[model samples]
Target: AAQTDAWDGVRALRADYRTATGERREVVLGDGTVLSLNTGSAVNVRFDASRRLVELLAGEILVISGHGAGSGVPLEVATREGRVRALGTRFAVRQQDEYSTVDVFESAVEIRPRDGSGAPLLLAAGRGAAFCRHASGAPHAVGAYADAWSRGQLIVDDVTLGDFLAELARYRPGVIDCAPAVARLRLSGVFPLADTQRILNMLPNSLPVQVRSRTRYWVSVEPAS
Candidate 1:
């Protein structure tokens, strides 16, 4: 039944996984690394005697390394920009069109730019950095509500309304446009990911914006009339 179907799904995604829009997925690698894929993400896993790697094809992922510091086989997550070698860590990687971002949560990681222009950065826990093919930016403290999506929550603390809408759009299938007039409005809350429409419905209650729905697949947040 459900469990059997779930296993079948896992087998199909072991080597390569591409989540449908609004869908999230989790996979366990042979070495016991746990990967949590965010909406619309794609990844491929490659493991050999000498190395274990996960290629992030699209979107974002949260990884918990299975191997310890003493383990001979190394675990790394690769994006188009470069590879993030996990130093026995828990971290998240987001592959954007122009650059890739990494947030170290538990231990540490080494960010190596694909072009190798500069020395690789050693990012410790509680820090994050963004890297392009040629360079990586200085590490910054992790955001207040970072990686909350992995736990089926979208926690916002004083983020702009536009930013919140952008994140909400990831878990939803349609376009959620926030008007410029309301884009800068401040928002802070813990919104559940299970029912995204409910989140939209409640937004007007807290903010001075109206949720205009042309269809379930299309929505607009406009300044209240």
Candidate 2:
């Protein structure tokens, strides 16, 4: 993909930040907004007199509004699908393939789709929603471990093996593939993000699966022999 300058408008100063695989980072904006970027995430910060905006070019961010200079300006996190306007709150936004997910942890947030086709939705505390270009899903209760990644942990609650591996792949440098035969196996555990290889090694003991490693950068989970 071609990289375009994020600060292309007049008087628009922008800063870009990114984290490589298996890394997490924090960024403080000029207006006192702290953003926690997850692994392999990228964000663009643009602040001016009129608006305070953080664009999620890729990945997820946990935003906490600060109360210092330039704090009164409403903070908005823009994704490909839409924008999440912080309403004196703390929230997290993740940019997905087809849509973006917003989870509110404190206060409320207003979501506006990019195409401006549907009514804007206000998500209150403890709620989450997904939105696309022209529509949005209704707000739902926040999941048990929706924000656990920020703590360097993966909390699984009877989630499918494939789904768990898919999430785990986001934190590592290479492929972690699950064979089709074991994809539907159920799993529940707390896997530490600090050691992804250990997680792969321990899976076979707890489940009917085998972890095959072609190299450190390539691995696969298949039905146990």
Candidate 3:
């Protein structure tokens, strides 16, 4: 991507705060908005007295827009897929290889795809949009993502056990994998804020699986006896 107009600090191309290929960081913007960047993320900052823009290069970001930023000056987060103009909204964006997931927790946002979708997608609170890189998406419901972020819980609604575990591994750092024996197990319910332990402990009782903890950070799930 070519650089934007004259960047900060006399640099041709400027990124407000950038991380390497495998680094994660937390950035606090001048306007009081906080961005929690997942691994391999880069963001260009455009914060002034009037407008606020965050251009994400890669990875995931958890955003909490500050209160009372102004009346008409909305906050925006842009990525390779499109731009998100937040109307006093709190949302998160995850840009991966295949698609980008936009989860809205509060207020509303306008999602504009660069592929020339004249009608931008409007997502309200507790809604989400998944933009497929290869093709257009059906715009299904992802209320779980939005609700979970707000309540600080992980609600897996009838998802495959493998898929459930795969998601649980993201919040925490380490290698936590599921065995094939429990791959087909179906799961539901909520995992409270930062409480992977509680979820792991209850899995065996709720489903036909055996959850064995190798360590506090490492766990494995298999078919029950």
Candidate 4:
């Protein structure tokens, strides 16, 4: 589930860490920075005399800066949207198709948009924000359970069935189609990501929907007849 690839480039040694679907991994970089990757996550790392940089290519990661070989230099994590400069802090970053989300758990972080158009924004602890190439949203309070997934649990509070399934899909393989007719049903609970099948099985007992599995790779939810 965890793979490491390294190669020497013209400037320095570059390493790539990736986690497969349904897998979570933790990696410690040469500089002592710890990265906890979520399912289907990947991070490319490079360190030199000048600076330390981490490129988040896909999925989500929780970063904890460590005092190690390269601890003197500032560490930056970049996504397509922009860059997040860690200020001796712990934070989480998640990449989307057109944007990226950053949640600050301790201390603060400085965000700079990729387009270089807007002023850099400072996000403090207990805050979360989203940004794209052109714009960044205002910082908002992070939910208490925002970091639950890192503990192998998914916690939802009055979330629609559709929204919850979309999130669950990230930790699962293949497709899980939720019918529009049942998408608006609301539910709240803490489900263990390690046992996805158990969560699917319990859905029928709580919600007025039926789970139909055509194959192990394909499943659907529809209104129970």
Ranking by lDDT: 1, 4, 2, 3
Scored by lDDT, the top model is 1
Per residue, candidate 2 scores C-alpha lDDT tens digits across 9-70 of 21122337887788899888776778999987888887877778898877899999876677
Residue 110, model 1, lDDT: 97
Model 1 lowest lDDT segment of ten: 4-13
Clashes of each: 0, 0, 0, 0
Tell me the spans in candidate 1 whose CA falls farther than 4 Å from its real position: 1-15, 68-71
Q: Give model 3's TM-score versus the native structure.
A: 0.68
Tens-digit lDDT string for candidate 1 (73-186): 879999878999998899999988678999999999999999977788999999999999899998999986798989989999999999999989988897998999999999
Task: List, residue by residue over 1-225, the lDDT tens digit for candidate 4.
Answer: 012222212112223887778989899888788999998887888789888999887789999988898789999999878999999999999988668999999999999989868679999999999998877898999988888888899999999999999998898899999999999999999999998878998999999999999899799999999
The local lDDT score (0 to 100) that residue 137 gets in candidate 3 is: 51
Clash pairs, model 2 backbone: none
Against the unseen true structure, what C-alpha lDDT does each candidate score? 0.89, 0.87, 0.70, 0.88
Evaluate residue 14 in candidate 2 and report its C-alpha lDDT on the 0 to 100 scale. Answer: 30
Candidate 1 root-mean-square deviation in Å: 6.6
Clashes of 4: 0
Q: Candidate 1, 137: how far from true, in Å?
A: 0.5
